[model samples]
Target: MKKTVVVGMSGGVDSAVAAATLVEQGYHVQGVTLQTWEPEDNATTSKKWQERGCCKIGLARFVAQRLSIPHQVLDIRERFRSAVVEDFIGGYSAGLTPNPCVRCNERVKFGCLMEAARDLGADYVATGHYARLLSGGTRGPHLHKGGDPRKDQSYFLYRLSRAWLPRILFPVGGLRKEDVWPKAEAIGLPADEVKESQEICFVTKG
Candidate 1:
């Protein structure tokens, strides 16, 4: 029987390629995009939000369709606001610098996606994060730096529960950033149409 994996697709090239690669590997892949924030009703604000780093539901669905896999959006806006956004504000107000990405990864992204995976009877939860997992060791699965040093995302994943390590997958972790683009292009994804955003999804530029 093929193992089922619920992939967190962020509508970006890396995630699109991740889902495609897993499907090619014969896993039953389901693409899921987390709606972590509420966009403003205005068209200009909505357009700006879409240009950010997260919640590209339309593009995510398109990628899923191209891969011939199932896709769905999981709304976790309230949870994100409380766990990540509010926490970020609190931290800043307290004179501490907080990395919202790290908090989101730990409290919202992996946490919520893992729950969804279980509800779907999935064997594992996967993401496009550029980090590697090393297993078969005396200490069990350990998270390691991805193959691409420049794009390594292990730092953002440090807060993940150790127990969930074995059930998590990083499909694009071994590929370099440049290599990921070619894979995205090969899969017929609109590589040029999607630009990678470096800013926080909920925080707009002034």
Candidate 2:
């Protein structure tokens, strides 16, 4: 039986390429997008909210259809609010600068999504994060910096439990950000058509 993988696609080039690569490598791949927030939540904030990336919601479905893979949008808004957003807000009240990405990766991505993958009988849960995983050794699994130092996301991923490392896949970690474009295009993916995702996906302003 082919091993199955549930890819957390954000509708970006890197994730698009990651899913495509895993499919090319003969793994049974399914794309999942976690919808963590709503525009109405930030409606009264500012004009920056207008810049929120709609691609995150729509494009993932587009990419999945293009790649001929099953796709689903998981509504994680309540979970994200308690696990990441509220934690981030509480951190500010306590005068601590919380890294929500780290929290999301540890709590939401690997934690929640991993369980989802297991329910689907998937052997692994993959993401487009720019960090590599070294597995199949006596030392267990090790997470390493990506090939592109400039875009290395190891820091955000350090909070992930060591146990989950074995089941995690970072398919694009070995390729530089620039290299992902061509690979994405090679798969007939609309890599350049979508605008780049914002730095902070949850917050509209810095």
TM-score of each: 0.93, 0.88
Q: How well is each residue in 113-143 modelled by candidate 2, as lDDT tens digits?
A: 7988988989999999899987758979898
Q: Give the TM-score of candidate 1.
A: 0.93
**lDDT scores in order:** 0.88, 0.81
Top-TM-score candidate index: 1
Residue range with the least summed lDDT across 10 consecutive positions in model 1: 40-49
Weakest 10 consecutive residues of candidate 2 by summed lDDT: 42-51
Alpha carbon deviation, residue 32, candidate 2 (Å): 0.9
Q: Which has the greatest lDDT?
A: 1
Tens digits of lDDT, candidate 1, 1-206: 99999999988888899899999999999899998866433445335325675777777877898899999998899999999999999999999999999999989999989998989999999999999999857889999999999999999999999989999999999999999999998988777767787888888789
